[model samples]
Target: MDLHPIEIVGRHPGPKILILAGIHGDEYEPIAAVRRLAGQIDREQLTGKVTLVPIANHSAYLRHSRVGTDQLDLARTFPGSADGTPTQQVAHAITGLIQQSDLMIDLHTGGLAMEISPLVGYMLVSDPSTLQKQRQMATAFGLPIVWGTTASLPGRSLSAARDANVPAIYAEWGGGGGCQAAGVAAYTAGCLQVMAQCEMLPSPAAAAPVDRCVIEDDRDTSGHLQLNYPAPHAGFYEPTLPLDSTVRPGDELGRLHDPFTSHTTTIYSTQTGRLFTRRVLPPVEAGDCLAVILEDPAETGTTNE
Candidate 1:
């Protein structure tokens, strides 16, 4: 197996925290945050070890693809085989690195399929001790949303961490397919908060507050999304609602058209809630996802109205 690439920023003899990002090439927010943290954090203040793996899948990242060249999802192949494919080797190496750390924080962001909320996901495992630590870390981050997977995801990741007896939490922020400056900052802050949690850095006074989400599945609880399109003829696409807008069932979302024929197609929402995510461009193919509707059970609040 190819040896994992780990960059140790802080000295040891204290606690150990592993910061992993770029498992998926498309998700650039986490990678960028790690880069900033590596340069910003003062080495002298660090009490333990801070290992940074900025690009876990360098091969896929270079090609700007989500999956590895072997058509494998590297994240799903943890505890991999020693003589397995290239992706599997990489996964195994990452798993080994995690085994040596006291805490693991895997950073991620929304992908092309959907734009998820700025939240941290703590995948529930069988170990109570690890679960408690995961919760503590999540709460410390102070992210607006904290989602619990309830169970470990299939394949690798949280499962491997469990097998290795390491406390790991996956924190996601911003929409991966697009760039958001504010979203990036929020994620970076959340990561920095980890230092305080591990006691590697000084904890703040009682004044440093935090938020809690009763349920992590904010999108599902909010509402269902419905896509709307008009007669279908268009030149490019233009959206009206923008992203993260709260809208009712009949609200106008955007329009599409055939560039050559100059035909216009109108799009609308079918549910009352918020616009959690939207397409970045226009002139998409038939059945292209233009926007998503996140219905709030309370029927209120949007990321950005």
Candidate 2:
């Protein structure tokens, strides 16, 4: 297999932390943040190694879609097959890097139709050892919000590293697509802090503690989300709480209907939690998703404040 060239700007030594971004391709914030971080890294601060693969999925990135050219989710094709499709080849290359890594931080962002907070995402595995390491890495970043994913078991993107006994965590921020200024800053700072934790950099800035929440892996945990704002009939969508609000069942999140005909329909939260994502464009179809609940705070520990 031809090795994908990963750029390095650190001194030769110490622990190695692999910062991978763009597994999904269209998630622009992570790629942008990596670019910004790469430009500012001091190679002399010398200690451990820091290797960055800012764009892992070249085809998906080029197409501006989540899936690669083969319509395969690159994140799921771990320890990939060399003789398989192109997506698998890319996955194999990434897995090789992770195998040699001491720690890893996969950067990500919400995609297509939803936005997620600038938070650290760690898979909540049942394995005691894995869980412990995940927690340690989660706390190390110190972002204001930590999101745990209980789904996508041991064969996904970072799974190879975790299986190899490496401590890795995924960091996410900004979204619907493109680099949001604040999100870029948050991710860059968090990434550096993680590198410092591994001694890849000296005296990296302190990371602010973020609220921790579990994004339950269930029938609803989707890699690419589509939030449909349905209209009871058809009209302009007038929203009340912008996307990503802490809401409760029966709480009116927005209203939709005929603005010209005066036919109004109120959108209510189906679950109690924060509204982390929604449709940016207004207007809706009958029975469409007005908004989505990220987690039910009481059971999930998510907070909007």
Candidate 3:
């Protein structure tokens, strides 16, 4: 779990920015995006050091799964131990890198399990300056959505950033395995945009569109995508509505059918918002999160950097 990161240093001194990908091995877009960034970004065009970890979890990637051979989620084992399992060692190393940097951008996708809309997110931390920087980075990412959620969750790279007082943000794109060209391109430009926004790049990156959706929720469960729309029974799930569509309460999300028992159950939405996440894989266990509604958000309007 060495987590060998690529470091690009700028001619001039500036912030040390860390950009990570492949926290979950099945998420392919981020890995490709980071690799693209490494080739595109030149030290002469940058004002600070940019560290890129294209494949943060090699063990899982080798197995073509989300978790490592140790069966531990690297995302949930942050600030991990040097004397622990492989995933824990990887987490510990990444957390050390996060603490050593001034800013961070952790890229992600839904992996092989679900499909997620392209969006950038940050924790709703108590520090105003850090929160503001996070917002700036999210806007600069030039994605369709900007999500600010609760900062209380533990065992994450963002949590390590929160504790280290380092400004950080994560981006999610469409996922269901394989590298989506659009997602890779967006992520590549997004990282450069963030560098420009932070004055690390000489050229100004493309500005985010006027109508980009911005949602900030500080509730305890704001960004937990795994808790929405639980399946009634273990079965094959088929979603009704498409991803990125708005849904009101009672809207049918999907159907669950117990393959052996032939029992079918239709799942409905419990909240109103965009359907940001929906399980793409058919088989699911009882209580597995089937759909995730973003919860109707009163637009925060165009956020300034």
Candidate 4:
């Protein structure tokens, strides 16, 4: 209940948007971008307020790994108990923040294990109005990939927003190491563009990418990025495909060389699409996600025209 959020109040009245980052500790770009934004807003020319949670899960952040010392992933423990584990308490506090917001943007990166192409994604909620708002927000964020996926997944910050009837979106960018400067700058500009779209800031519409690929997939696991390309054995993963590479079904995604033996297992792409994510961390467990090949929307019949 003692979550400290940065509040930037505008002189005028408009929509109060909540911008969140650091839901996972290892993802640094969002946290840095949020901090930068705290100092960049011009209250004199703005409307409404911006509430920023630069580090939503301090517990996880302190550990320097994806999960906290309690080994709970804050992203998957949302709307948590008031008196639960530290990560759960953080989730509960963020849920409260989401409930009081008119708009929400949760930012993330691939963390230490994965690299992701820059993208803005939203849940494919049932409400048409919310969905439209989300689509607009994602567009305004101006990422190369605008993704709309199934909303049935629970325990996420977006799910909490959905329950509170608030339109929300999240952004992801390059990762698998320390925060990249490009990722930080991109996130800052993206947040400002979203604010402009919400009438909280004075700026022209964010320039839409000339080659943007907008996708709307309702498959139950469309948004589940970590559930793909599981390692056949716990070994050192050597990914063959790079991020955003055009991948064909049956193409080798990567190889897992047995850490204890000379055997290597080659993982193949299951769908024809782009390689949206690749594992940068070599040490992998049997079930660790090695890569995530975003299925081609054309094949899935889920393209946004």
> What TM-score goes with each of the models?
0.72, 0.77, 0.95, 0.96
- Candidate 4, backbone clash total: 0
lDDT of each: 0.69, 0.70, 0.89, 0.89
Query: Candidate 1: misplaced stretches above 4 Å?
Result: 1-6, 9-12, 176-179, 204-212, 216-305
lDDT of 2 by residue, 219-254 (tens): 335322343334466556666887657888888877
lDDT computed for candidate 2: 0.70
* Model 3 RMSD, rounded to 1 decimal: 3.3
How well is each residue in 173-223 modelled by candidate 4, as lDDT tens digits? 998879899999999999999999888999855365557999888888889
Q: Cα RMSDs of all predictions?
A: 5.9, 4.9, 3.3, 2.1
Which residue pairs in candidate 4 have backbone atoms (N, alpha carbon, C) closer than 3 angstroms, thus clashing?
Answer: none
> Which 10 consecutive residues of model 2 have the lowest summed lDDT?
216-225
In candidate 3, what are the lDDT values of residues 20-134, reduced to their tens digit? Answer: 9999989999999999999999898889899999899999999888899999989989889999999999998999999999999999999998999899999999999999999
- Candidate 1 local accuracy as lDDT? 0.69
lDDT of 1 by residue, 94-195 (tens): 888888888888887755544556667676666889888988888877776665554544455666777877887787665536656776676677777877
State the weakest 10-residue window (summed lDDT) of model 3. Answer: 296-305
Q: What is the lDDT of residue 73 in candidate 4?
A: 90
Task: Please list the residue runs of candidate 2 whose C-alpha ends up more than 4 Å from where it truly belongs after superposition.
Answer: 1-4, 7-12, 126-129, 151-155, 206-240, 253-267, 281-292, 296-305
What stretches of model 3 exceed 4 Å from their correct place? 205-210, 297-305
TM-score for candidate 3:
0.95
